[model samples]
Structures are given as structure tokens and as C-alpha cells.
Target: MFLASSAKPIDESLQNLVVEIETQNPDLLVVAARQLRYSLQQTNIELTITEPRPFNVLEEFIIRAGIEFEPAPTPQELASLLGLDPVFVQSTIKNLQKLQTLAPKSPITVTEQGRLFYDKGAVPQPPYAVQIYAIADSLGETVNFQAEPLNEVVINLPSLTSILQLNESNNLISTFNLEQVQKNLQASGLGLHVPETGKIVTAFRSIGSTQTIWRKISLFLIFDSTTEKLTIHLRRGKQMLDSRSKWLDLLLSEGKISLDTLCKLPNESLNFEREAAKKYQNAETAARLEKIHQQALGNSQKKEVIQLRDREINQKFLEIINTAKQQIIIYATWLNHLNINPEFIAALEALAKRGVSIIISYGLEWEPENLLEIKEKLQAIKTPEDLPSVQLLGLEEDVYLQEIIIDREIYQCGFYHWRNSHESHIPLGELVYQVKKSQIIQEAYEILSTRCQNYAQKLWQQAVEKCDIQLARECLCIWGTLGKLETSLNQIQKNNWLELLPIYLNVVIHNLKSHNLADDSPILQSSLLLLSQVEAEAAFIEQLRLAYCQLLSAIAQQNPDTALNLLNNEVWAQFLRLHIAAETDSPTEFISQQTSQPKTKRKAAAPSTRNKKTKA
Candidate 1:
């Protein structure tokens, strides 16, 4: 929705949100919008909470024993008879006397209160003083009634008359009832100190209350990177409220706030973080290459092995599946007992949407009925193209091996049933060995399941052909030398050149920054040469390449006007801007260097935890 200024701005309420945005991501810029001030009637409530206080087993037993016997037994006699310590018995007697359940004299005799407590099954309802603050909105609705504290709901905003206010309902204050207060107190989790099943408000009376209090709601501008769109979000207490909030719905219905609006607004940039600045500064090309080469050698040489059991298997296995960016190969026996729950299905669906190749291979044939069901469920989530494949290897011999290979690197193998494991019950402890992928293991796996080997090889080939670097050595060799890059580009499709451009550009920029090389460095020159060649071939690629190249050049030469002009004109250049911003010391370092003018500050409201806001 379009933003407008509110008369009484709650600038102080937004400071904490500013600090959070600055800390988490400086990319987001906060702007002010008009706020909705609603009235809340604060009533000082006094109520008696009846809680069931049950007597301990020993206390009950002692009272029962005294009542059953003709003459009550003395502490010494009872202790001796029950084989209990005399001192312990004496202490219990003292406690019983304090409760007025037994006589305070020499003989341990049950009193009238004791007989009544025993008759009522040893559960006594104790009354408690409930001095609580309850809040109610102008809509005849009680606020913070659902397991939330009152201190967090009510905002102390002075001078409510200066801001625009919503009309208070005439019956809002008169609608207070004992039943409502009781339900609220129960839901609010008050009187937790009482050891009882119920925190029922037995009695409620009004001590005092305010006429009407106002709370200022704030607006937030959220940027969705995927969609490349900005949207407005409203704040409720410490949370950026969802669309389902009653307040938001009410405002939308009244036309106080629009559901959709696009407005370009002025905003301020946050200072760059010092810790992040140190990460990308003064990197040398040779040193970076050497490090990459070493890491490659180490990964191939060493295999980290971990043994997982019970819930650890679930955690580690899910982690591998969830973090998979390229491919996932699961080799198991069958899907007869596989749960195929919503969560597992959802994860697979998300991975499929991300274009991850999934290959599920079963050694033995799956039961026909179960196979058909699993196939139908999986087939429903498939994209137009045959993305994920589930198959059974026609094997006569019984196989016991199972493994999950993520990105053809991390390998987890054992007898643990990855799919058949129940979610409700923690799976039985089993030895599952997790190790880094190796050639020997890969060959052995392929031999056991040859049906999927060709498909896996084809996928790997396709990935490499797209210039998607899977190994550190490949990144170093291809980007390190211009000749190697030219040779690789010959194999990649012309249509995929746009995708390849970014990979090449990133490598070039990374080398430039790490080596702290000049603009004319061989890596930079080679990248520019490739860009020129691609631009000469494809007109569309040329346009994108030019925008990015110009942005890069502007950043290097400290030309803020040129960079800003490109950013304003080209939406595609946003990524390039973000890349340069991340690499530089300050996110706005380029703009600040060329243009000395500061942006106009805009007052806006956003959400933040009260605790965090206070600290900020």
C-alpha cells in the first residue's frame, strides 16, 4: 500500500527495528507510514483463583490411619509400628498440625478440618488473591487473552489526542464478565506457582480502570528477493503480524489501509558491519588459489566418519537431504514400510522445485500395492520433465545394503531404514556410518545398483557441461587460466551462456579481490574478453553482460553517478549491485564516496521484541 505520514509519529518505537535490520541485513531499508491508534480499556481486576491442593501420600496415609484406629497412635508408636524414623514421623505430625488437620496435643487425633479434607478425597480448593491488569480493545474484544502476558500487549503512548484515533464502542467497557476474565487468566498462564490442575478464577471484581488508551501500529517494507517485489507489513507488539490478525483485517475492511500499493520512498542506509568488512578485504589471488587447491586435495584424501544412532540418524539424514543443492541418491531395499508423511513429501517437493535431481533405487522388488501407492504420490509432485525417479532393480539375490549419497560427496550407509522409520517413535538404535564420498565406494555402489548408474553419469555430465563447478580444483583451474575457460565454454550451450556468465564473473571478481589485483589483472582481462565474445554472439546476453560489466567498472573506478544511473535504469543490475555492496567495506561506500549528500530520514514503525528494543 502507498505510505502517508501520521500526525503523531512513534519514532521511538521504530529505533529497535532499525538496529535489528542493521544487524541482520543492511540491505533492507525501513520507511515510515501512517499508524492506526486504537483504544484499550485497562481494568484493574481482583479475582479469587480456586486451585485443587492435594495432600501428599504420607499425609493422607497418616490421617487415614488416625481415623481408622479407635485411639489415635502417638508419633513414637506409629513410627515404631510402620518402621519409620521417629524424627520423620514427628516432622510429619508437626506439618499435619500446621494444616489444622490434626490435634496439636500429645495424641495425634484427627480434627474437624481433617475429617472434611479426607471426605473430599484429600483435594482442597484454596482461594488466592488475583491482582491482575486486563486489557480490552475498542472492538469489545479482550487483548492478550491467549497465553500472552499483559505487560507485552499494552503500549504506554502519551498524548493519544494528537494522533488519529478509532472510535471506541459504547459497550466495550461494559462487556467485561467473570467468565471472560476466568478464561483469559487460564489462557494467560497466570498463577503457575500453585501446584494444581486448575487455575480457575472463582471470583472477579473490578477495582479500577482507565477510560481509553491508544496504541500506535507501525508499517514495514519487506523485500522479497525471489519475486523482486516489495510489500507492506504491519506490526503487532513484537511481531510482524500475519494477514490473519483481526486488527489488520479490520483496517483493511474500513479502507484505512490498502491491500496492494507500490510506492518509491526515500530511506536511509545503515553502516556496514565491521566483522563482515574483515572477511573479504585484502585477499591475494595466489594465496586463495593455493588454499582452494589444498582444500580439494584434502577433501579427496581424507574421509570424515560419523556413527549415528536413534534420533541422531534422523537429524543428520534430514540435514543431508535438506541442504542438498544439486543431487540426492537414495539406495534402499524397498518402500513397503515407508511412512511417506507430509513432512518428507514436502521436503522432496521443495527440492524438486529447486531443480535437484533425485534418484531412488530399491534392490529388491517392492510389494505391488505399496509400490503403486508410493509411485502415485511421488508422480503427483513431478515437474513436466521427469525430474525425480523411483525404481526397483531386478535382482534375484537378497541385498541388505542401504546408502544416501548427497551431491555425490557425503555418503551415509547402514541397515537403518531411512523411509520406513516412524516419526512418532524414535527409531531403534542402529549403526549408521557416515563418510565422505570416495571412488571405491562409488564404484561399489554402482555395481550393486547398475540401473541408475547411467542416469547419474548423464546428470553429472550435464551439470559439468553447464559450467556448474562441483569441485574446488575445477573452480581454480577453470577461472585461474583464461585458456582453460575458453576451452570449457566451447562445450557449453549458447543458451546457457547467461548462466555461465555469472559463474565466470564471480570467480574473476573473487580472484581480483582475494589477490588484491589491479583492474588490468589477467583474470579481469580474461573475464572482459569472454564477456566481449559472448556479447558479440548473443544480443540479449550482451545487454545483461554490459549492465553487469558497467556496474563492476563503476564500483572499481568509484563512479557513483554511473553506478546509480545503471541501478535506477536496470532491474537486472540489482544482483550486481548487491554483489559489489557485499564485497566493499560499506554497503553504500560507492555512493558515499562520489556523492557527499545524505538521504532524508523517514519515520516509520516496525516490530521488535520489547526486550531487544529496550536493549537497543
Candidate 2:
């Protein structure tokens, strides 16, 4: 029953023995060691096993054998027996103690049961514990018997040749299966879902190796449904690259790209398509809603308003153009100097080319001299077979007035013609309806269009036939006469004439003057004569005389200073005396006496201050 004590070196033989035992009875080592130690100790067998190793390799066996010793094995002896360096063994033991794997136990010692009579130590009992100690040493030191859980498996294939050599094995079949799976995903437009806890079992061969290798590679994938995010987790694999979102946005914005090509991509491409589909669906919904809203609202009223305004403007514009039968007269504040816009020049050019008369008057501010430059450029054309030559008049003086008279019947007056510096240099002008078909307007247009040399002939004929100047003078006199009449008339009658008489006079005068007819000029003489012939009071005659004088003054003021100076001396002095008398309550006798005085010699001078301030 004694335990054996021996120091044996670890060798291949012992390793083989442990391997055989582990294979035969894997569960026996621990159970057998415990059973043998308990059985030998029950027989009171004392065993002592000593080692010089610093770590106590036999300490556990010694304790179980019920033996006590003064010193344990030395460090070097423990190191040799365990096939480990002394430092490593000592550190490991210390660590085990700190981990509480080796807890404190009562030390075995010889002691008397009763008070102090030591029977001279009876022959020490045979050390039966040595046999159990030896068995415990063998069991604990058996590395092959240690059980390890199958945590991971690895295989290596040195080359492709080795893989081919192992064709008969399942490795080839597994490789083929993986390839087939990849192909199926590519063909079906399905993406492979790698499991979150799965591993990649790779089988490969070295370049010239005879054997194939198998390795388990870790991999995982996650799909977050809430966020619509897909992530592939590969422990030892490269990430996939795709430009699905970019390509999809491009296709959505441009509405050009083939859908068939997208669907033909491999399984890995599905994530991109998923995102694209969501975006496209949202856009489609929004567009459909917008279309529905637009359909519900009608635009009939808006269309009608636009149509009415357009028609009114167009009709007025056409009337202005059509009135220019023989000649077109235009007075624009500024004209498009570059001749690039719609202007009187553009219209007149068309008309003149067609043998119709055209005349234009525009301010010098518009750079009308530029017209000459343009003319030069046009003239430079080597082949001027059919281009029309246009006449331009730049009014550097008296340029403040802006008006257009077309063929006497049509006239336009407004600020619409001036193109502001900040605005586009386009022609824009308004037309005023005058006679609507009067001879006066027609003559004005003709006069404007006449050649410079022919202007005098036209003027002479107009003075006689139309008497435009005389009519204008008569109208001025009538306007003054009407103002005096309003004071003597009844309130109701005054209002009626106030509204009607001026309108009638304006229409008649405009018709006569526009046609250049001087026939209405006799109205001035006839009206004056009628007053003188009437047996009316001196006051009434004085009123008429004063009106005549004022009309003359207005005429003088509006005309050139030279024209005003051309008046007859006697006639001019008489007119001036009449105007002065109208402003005062002078005796009729005094006015008559003043008028009888001989005309005094006077220097040629501009119109008087009273006349110069008179408005047309």
C-alpha cells in the first residue's frame, strides 16, 4: 500500500502512454487519482517524494499521502520535471495561489493524544502512500489527457495543384457549391444574406502543394429594418463597392438610363437599388399630387383679361400705322440708335422702300447722328440692290416736345416713347387719336415727309388751301373769347358751353390745322367783323378785341422770334394796345384815341414779355 517515489524525465514514451490512456479511458485520470489517494491513506501509508524544483510538483501528492517534510523540491528540479523554466513554474504557482485555486489546508504533523508521554517512536509505519503519490504524479503531468473544447478549426492549402490532388474529397464539392451560389445570386438579382454568426469555410491549395487546406473564416451581416440600413460584417474579407445611389439620382433627374442593366447586376448590388426605389417612389407621388392640384384650378378668367388688354393695345397700334397713307410723321424723344429695335426708322424704312413717304423727328439726346454712321455702314455694302434709304432729322433745339402725327388723322402724345437709360433700348411709343380721318392730320404727315427742298412748295400750298396757321390762330382767339363768354352766361348755360364749346372748337380747329387748310383762317376775320358790325356795346367789342390781341400774343410766343418780328408795324401796335386796354377799365374814348396815334418807329426785337409767356 506504500506510495512510490521517483523523479522521471518527461519523454516521448510517457507522452505516448498518456495518449493511449486518454484514448482508452478519457474519464479515468481524475477519478482514478482521487480513488487511489483515498484508498492508500485509509491504510495509514506514509509516502515521501522529493524534488529539487522550486515549484512543489509533489506537494499535493505529499499532502494526500499524509506526509510532512521540512523543505520542498528545489526550483531547478521542479523545472526539469515539468519541462518548464523555473521562473515560469514559480510564477504560475503564485498566480494559481492568488486565484485561490490552491487554498490553505491544515499541515500534517505527529502529535500525542494524551499529555506528553512519547513512547520512543515505534517503528514508522510502512509508506503505503508512495504508490498513490506516483499515480497522482503521472495523472497530473499527462498533457495529452487535458481536454480542450473544439473552439476553432483551421486548414491551409499551399497551392492550386494541391487542391486538384484532393479532387476526390468533399473539398472540391464545397468549392463548387460556393461558386454556384454566387452565380445564382448574379442571375436572379438576389443579394446573398451572410448570417451574423456564421463563418466562411475556405478550402484552398498551395501553388505546388500535394494536399489541400481548409480554414474557417469569420463573417457576419446585419440588416436594420427600422433604419433601412444594410451592413455586411466580414471578419476577414474585403468590403464591396457600389455607386447605386449616385447612379440612381442621375437617372431620376435626367430620366435617362436603362433599367434592364441595373437589374442584371450581382446580388451585392441590391442595396443600391433598394435606396433608389424609395426615392423614385417619393418623387412620383409628389408629381402626381401636383398635377391633380393644377387640374383642379382653371385659368379662363386670367386668359380673358390678357386677351382683352392685348387686343386694345394692338388695335391702337394698327390705327397709328394705317393712318400714314402718304407720309408718316414720328416725334420720338429717343430712338434706338443702333437700328436694332422696332422704331419709326424700321417702320419708315419698310414703307419708304415700298414707295411710301417716311419722316422721323427725334431728340439729339438719342444720338441721332449715329443714324449717319449706320447709313454709312449700310452704304458700304457692295451690293445695295434693294435696300431703302431713310431720312433722319435730329432736333437739338426744342427737343422737349414729344409727339407723332401720322397722315394728319393719327397723332400720339405721351411719355411712353422715352427709353430710360436703365431700360432696354427698344422703341416704345403711344399714339393719340386726333381727327381719326381728318385732312388736317393727313397734311401734317405729308409735310413731315416732304423733301427739304419740296417743303416750301408744300408749305405754300398748305397755307392757301388748308390755312393751318390761320386756323390755329383762330382757335386761340376762340378759346379766349369762350372764357369771357362764360362769365356773362348763366351758371347752367356756362357749364354746358364750358364742356361743349371748347370741345367743338378743339375738334374743328384740329381738323382744319391737321389738314394744313387755311380756309378756317377766315373764321378769325369773319368773327372780328361780326363783332364790329353788331350794334353791341363798346364793352362787348372791347372783349372781342382783347381776345384777338391775346390770341396773337400766344401765336407770337410759340413761333420763332424772327417770325414774331415779321408782323406789320401798325397791326402789331394796335394788337398790343388792345391787350393793355383789356387788362384795365379804360374809357372807350381813351382806347379809341390811343389807337388813332401814328405807329412809332421801333427796333426789331423778340416778342414782348407778356407774349413770350403766353401758352398755346
Candidate 3:
């Protein structure tokens, strides 16, 4: 039989796509062409109408498209994103849907094969820490969060909200759900042990709350100068319970503490119920005050007729605002009356009544006073029980997008936040006039949301200049969480962030240079493979003169073995040549400088927690 199939002529993008057709009969062959474009209806990538289609070729195309391309773009949108034909995009998207490679969900969801391919393609997999860091960063970008404790996801990290709190999805951290150990975790004291400087601070907490009633703990992290070891300290304080709630039962069984801390007394004394009645009396008073307040907030105001396109956008935005269970993040630079409108404020006030924490982040301006005044008013619209939180950035960040996230259920992000009421400022390409910015380029995304949240957290971390025990220890604990990796070298490859290596190396170099040498500054040793790569592409090592000198000096003073390792590496030798005081290219001058200071060994701390090797 002759080879015949219904894909139209292949484009440049589909040309690179690896398609595999599993034919039922070995002898039969098929020829594929690119499909239709702008038909208003749909077509297939491989239209084999004669017999039972294997669907393998279709699945392969979808998997490749999904993993490699982004924003879950449709074949049409993907074509636009990649500068391909709309017909080719449409055909590819249809075939993928037929084969079930792409989920029917909006913005498209890739099948498991797509996920696995993306995971396995990393040249070297960054360990869990980097993955966590990267995830947190993505969430922050997706949801434009402002400053507040636990408000941002911190990049590449498991969703902090997903991990810390439960939602309708019940997608909490499966390994160690906080609910299982909530009492202990929420009441515990947070500590970060930094061996570099012996300084320590007793308390670390959110603003307004004076005492450090930690919601999370940072285990001690030690970076060994002699061995390049990263240890995650695990030892925890009291108030933590054993899983299964047995810790409390076990504690009561053991008869350890008094009735003061445990859930209940084993025996009910005559004094108890009478004491509870008085508590009820006080609650009754509070209920009466709540009733009075509720009367003040009469019937919901009449809905405004917004002139925006797509009525669905308005409905969805209000739905998210009205039904947020936990957290709401509004990152809008343009907060004027024309932009924000009255309906938006009413939604915000309604959610405030439900104890949904709302954070309003205005874009950073040259002068922040006007934004601060706006924030003051937003904060004023609060219920007696729950107050809306507003953050006026002292930041100089110039992000031009507005993002709104209601828990993880809904998210909206776009460049429309930059537009003012003036028609001149409207985006030139977007012809759809009535659509809300959130709906115009609909990318209903979760990963991007997580990334946005994570990015915000890192920004917060970077913003904190002082190294109190809490901040220092928390930052250091990442090394401890880094655990078995020993150095960023083994871990860097796993992340598949080779393209971003120059940026990362610059950061590591900055850290090394800034750290005080007397403070037992730790150097992250890298494999010769990575170092050579860095040396060839970016020349990162050559730029780190003081850092290289400090590292060589430390190795020379303490670990002769480490000094041998560096000297043996060909990539490091060329970098070392830049530091030769005189001629003749010898690292002995830097080594000599290192030897001048007597090396004092600071003892490394042991890993503190159980499951010492597992990812936190």
C-alpha cells in the first residue's frame, strides 16, 4: 500500500519534532504533511483515517511540545510564541488532545510522560534544595506578592502555602503535613546556628508579634572549611509532637508535665465546668458585639457595569475575591480610582470579613508617600476580627505586571497593569477592547504562580540586611537542607540551570568575597568538570580574585588535601595565574598569604534531626 496521511506541509518547528508511528502492519508506511491553518474548526497533526490509529506519533508530538514549550500554549498560541503558523499550532494541539497527551484543562496540561521527560533531561539534577529554591522563585513571579512573613513562596521551593496550610484540594506536604505536628511546630522557638560568626539572637518573628512564636524551624547548618561538608542540624525543641498525635498521648501516659500544657486533664475536677461557663459568658459578649458590626454592613452593594471585555473575567475575579479561604495577594502598581474601582474594594472588604489575609502591594515608585497613603486607606477597610494587611514597598523594583492569586485555585497575571485610563497607554497588539487584562491572554497557571511566590520570598530574604540569629540560621539551614551534596558542584548539574551558571557563580563569588575571613568563611568547592565549564564559557573564577585568594589561603592553612585538589585541577590553575604577585605564574604567593595567619579550627556542629539524610 502507498504511504498516505493528512498532515499538511511540515514547518520549521514540526521539522524538529520527533514523531514515531507504531503501525499495526509492518509493511504499510505513511507520509505526513502539515495540517490546515485558520479554519475556525480543528484538524489533526497526523490524520490517518483509514484504520485504527496507533496514537503513538500524536502522543510523542504532544509530549515534546508540552515539555519544551511553556505557559501550556495551544498549538496556535505555541506557534505565536515560537513564531510558527497558526494552522500548524492548531493541528498539533488537536492531535495531542485526541491522544490524551494534553489534558482538557484550560492552558493545557501535559501528560505524565511530558513531566518525566522534563525531569530526566537535566544534565545534572540539582538536589532538592535547588529544586525547592527554583520552585519558590517561579511561584513568586506567577503571583506578585509583597513583603510579609510567609507571604511569598521563595523560588523552586515546594509551595509554602501548599505545604503549610490545607485547602479544598488537601494538597499539603504529604511527607510531613504540619497538621500532624502543628502544636509543636507553631509553639517552637526558631534558631539558626551560624559557625562563621558566634553572634546569636534570641527571637525572630513576624511584625507586630513581639515574641518569637515560630511557625517553622531552621535546623543548624554548618559549612566545613576542611572537608566542604554541608550538614542539616535536626535537634528540635519541646512542643513538637510525635506523628499520629501519640506524642501528646505518650506524654500524658508518661505523666511528664502538669495540666498546664497538655490537651486535657485525665480527671475532670468539679472546678472545670464552672470555669468553662465563665469563658462562655465572655464569648457571648463578643458575639453580641459581632452582631452589632454585621448589622452595620447591610445588603451587598449593587454590582457595577464594568465596560471590560469578557463578562467571565469580571465574574471569575469576583468569585476568587469572595471565596478566598486563606490568603490573597494583590500586586498592582496602578492603584488609582479608575484602575482599582469601587467593586474591587467591596470584594476586598467582604473577604476581609472571612479572615482571608489580603496584602496590597503597590509598585515601587521614585517617591513612595502617595502609595503609603493609599495603603493606609486600604488597611482601614477591615473587620474587627481580621484586618487587611498592606505593604508599601521601600523597594526600587520595576515590575510592570499585576497578579492576583486566590489560594491556588485561581491566578491572573498580565502586562495590562501598566495601562492607565488613557487610550494611548493601551497595549498596541491586543485588539480585544472589552476583555480584562487577566482574561485577554489567559494562561491559567500553577507553576508560574508558585514561581512568582518563590521569587517574592527571595526578594524578602535579600531585603533583610541584618543577620540576626533567625535570618542567619535560616539562610544557613539551606546548606544543612543541602545535606549530602557537600557542594553546589554535584548539585548544580541536577538543576539543569547551566545557562544560568554565570549568574550563580557570580553570586557564590560575591558571598565568598563579602564573608569575613576570620569568621571561618566557607568556600563551596566545585568539581573540575563544572569549574572547567565555568572557566571556558564565563571566566567566573578569574573574576573572583579575592574569593580565590581567600579560598586558596584557607585550604593552604587548614586542609593540605583540599589545596592539592585545587592545584591539580587544570581549570583552577589558569584562574590561579591571575593572582600571581610577581611573574612566573605560581600560586605560592597566595598560599604564603594564607600561611601567615595561624589556622584555628572551629568544630563543626552535628546534624540535629532524625531522618538526617532526608529532604525537609
> Which prediction has the highest TM-score against the true structure?
1
What clash pairs does model 1 have?
A: 32-603, 32-604, 283-514, 283-515, 284-514, 284-515, 285-515
Candidate 2 yields a Cα-based lDDT of 0.32
| lDDT of each residue in 281-381, candidate 3, tens digit only | 34533453343334324413421112223334445556657877655555544554114445766776776555454545444554334656655666577
Q: How far is 366's C-alpha from truth in model 2 (Å)?
A: 5.6
Better lDDT candidate (1, 2): 1
lDDT of 1 by residue, 482-586 (tens): 223443344333334444555445434433332323444343333433433443235354434434443354344544443443333232233333232222234
| Candidate 3 structure, TM-score to reference | 0.23
Instruction: Estimate every model's Cα lDDT from 0 to 1.
Output: 0.49, 0.32, 0.36
Better of 1 and 2 by TM-score: 1
Model 2: how far residue 225 lies from native, Å: 93
Candidate 3 local lDDT, residue 609: 46
Error of 2 at 159 (Å): 99
Model 1, which residues run further than 4 Å from truth? 1-38, 51-120, 123-131, 137-180, 187-189, 192-199, 207-210, 228-231, 236-256, 259-616
Q: TM-score, each model?
A: 0.30, 0.19, 0.23
lDDT per residue, candidate 2, 238-262, as tens digits? 2322222333334434645322222
What 10-residue stretch in candidate 3 is worst by lDDT? Answer: 38-47
